[model samples]
Target: MSVRDLLVLGSASAVPTKARNHNGYLLRWDGHGLLFDPGEGTQRQMTYAGVSATDVTWICVTHFHGDHCLGVPGIVQRIARDGVEHPVDAVFPASGAAYWARLRHASAFRDTGVIRERPVSGERMPLDTGDAPFRLVARRLSHPVEAYGYRLEEPDGVTMLSGELAARGVRGPLVRRLQQDGRVTAPDGRTVTLEECGVTRPGQKVAFVMDTRLCDGVRELADGVDMLVIESTYLDEDAALAAEYGHLTAAQAARVAADAGVRHLVLTHFSERYRAEDEPRFAAEAAKAFDGEITLVHDLDRIAMPRRRTSGGGA
Candidate 1:
C-alpha cells in the first residue's frame, strides 16, 4: 500500500504565474520524500501539497538556476524551524558549491538542519547501495551549469500467489512458514518451495529530468522509465528559442519520451509566456508524439503511480 510517483509543488519555470508557483516537485516513495529543484515559494507549496520538511529524506538540485533552486534558503530555514533531526541526503552540482553554500546559509535562522552533501563527480553516479526502495542514478545534461538529471529504478521483487499455495495444501501458519523459509513441509509431508508458488521479478522505475536540452543524457535518463518528469519550457512555436537556451519544447519533450519508451510523461517547468488555460494544449501536443499518458503538472497536484502490469512491470 505504499504511495509513489510524483507530487508537484510548483510546475512553472521562473516566476509564479497566477496558476503556478515556481519550480518544485516531490517524489514520494515508500515513507521517504524527495524534493527536486525547489524554486521560490516552496515552503508554502509544501504546505499545499501536504508535504512537510520532516517527510523529506532526500534533496536534489539539477542545477543552480534561479528557477530551479532559488528556494533553498527558505527550505533550509523551514527545516530548521520544524526541528527535523534526521540527516537529509543532498545532491547538487559540485560546480555550484558556492551557490549551495550561500543557499544553505542564506538568512541564517537557528542552526539545526543537516544537509549532507552527496554531489555528483562525473557523468554518472549511483546514489544507493542497491538495497534502497529505488536505485538512483544521475547523468550529466547539457545545461549552462553543472546540471544533472536523476533516475529511480525499483528492484524486482517476489510476488506470492495465494492459489498456488492453497492448491499445494499450504495453509495458515504453513503459508507464513513457507514464505519465511522459502520452502516448507506440507501436512502430508510434501515439500513445497517458494519459487514454485511465488514470482520474484523486477520492480518499477521512475526518472526526473529538468532544465536540459535534447541531449544524449536526457534520453539515457528517460530510458524505459515508468514515469518521466521533465521540463517543457517552451511550446513548439518557440523551438528556436528553446534550442538557443538549451531547453526543450513540448513537442520535442514528447518525442523524447516516445523514443525513450517512457510509460508516463509529466511535463513541467513551463515558461510563463503560456496562459493559464494553455496546459491542455501543451499536454495534447506532448501526447501527439508520445501516446502514453501525458500530464501537464500543476502546483500541489498528486499523481499516483500506474498499476503494475501482469508482466510484473509498470507504466
Candidate 2:
C-alpha cells in the first residue's frame, strides 16, 4: 500500500530544549522519502521515528542555518554507512554550496557517490526528478539568509468511475485502453472517451514553508495545497520578534493557510521560550483564523496527509 505522512523528527527552532530537539521533518510520499531541514540529532531522531537513512530519497534544506542543515553530515555519513545504493538528491540554495559541501564531507565515513547535488538558484525553479510522480519546485522565501521553500504537486489525472464504465459497457482491457488512449471502442461498437467514464481528480499538493516571514513566496507555496507544514516560531504576542527573526507567528501561519485553502496546517519549528503547556495556546490562536485541521507537532510525531478531495473540489 502507498503511504504518505509527515514524520516530525525534531521540532525546535534555533535552540533545542529538553522537550524539543532541533528542526527535522520526514515526509513519506508513496515510495519517496523527503527529509527536510534536518538539524542536530536527526540520525538518532530517525531511529526513534522508525525510519532509516535508506528511506530517504531526497534531502531538502531550506537554508544553511545550523538548525536546518547541521544534520547533513551525520545523515550523509549514515547513508554511506548503510550502503544506500539509490541516488539521494540534496536540494538547497545554490548560494550555500560551500556550506553544503562542508557538511556533506564533514568527516565522511565511506563517502558514497550516490548523493546527487541539486542546488536551486532561481526564484521558482523545478528540481529535475525525471519521471517522478510529482513536480518539486523551490521558491525563494523572505529570510535573513538565502532561503527557499519546497512544494510538491502531483499532476491532475482522471479517476475512472466504475458506474460510468459499466453503463458504457466498458470493461476489462477496454478500460485500460480508454485510460491510456483517452478513447476506446466498446464491444457494442460504441466509442467512449475518457471524460465520459472518468472524473477529473485534482492532484495532491503539499508545501514545506520553513524559516520564512510573511512573504509572497509563502503564499505561492501554500496556495491550494492539501497539507502545509510551516514554521510558527512565535505566538501572536511576539509578532515583532517573529518579524525581526524572519519567522512566522501562529496567527500569521494560520491566516496564510486560511487564505490559501490549505486542508491540513502543521505548525512547527517553535522557539524554546514557549513551554510545553503553552502549545495549546498556539492552536487556539491559529483556530481564530484557519478552520481546517491544525497540528502542533512534537518530536517523533507522525501526521498523515489528508485524503484526496472529491472531484470538482479544489485541492
Each model's lDDT comes to: 0.85, 0.94
lDDT of 1 at 308: 68
For candidate 2, the 10 contiguous residues with the lowest summed lDDT are: 306-315
Structural similarity to truth (TM-score) of each candidate: 0.90, 0.98
Candidate whose TM-score is highest: 2
lDDT of 1 by residue, 110-154 (tens): 876486888786989888623447788889999777889998888
Query: Deviation in angstroms for 120 in model 1?
Result: 1.1
What does candidate 2's lDDT look like per residue over 239-264, in tens digits? 99999989999999999999999999
* Models, CA RMSD each: 2.3, 1.1
lDDT of 1: 0.85
lDDT of 1 at 129: 26
Cα lDDT, model 2, residue 39: 99
State, as a TM-score between 0 and 1, how close model 1 is to the true structure.
0.90
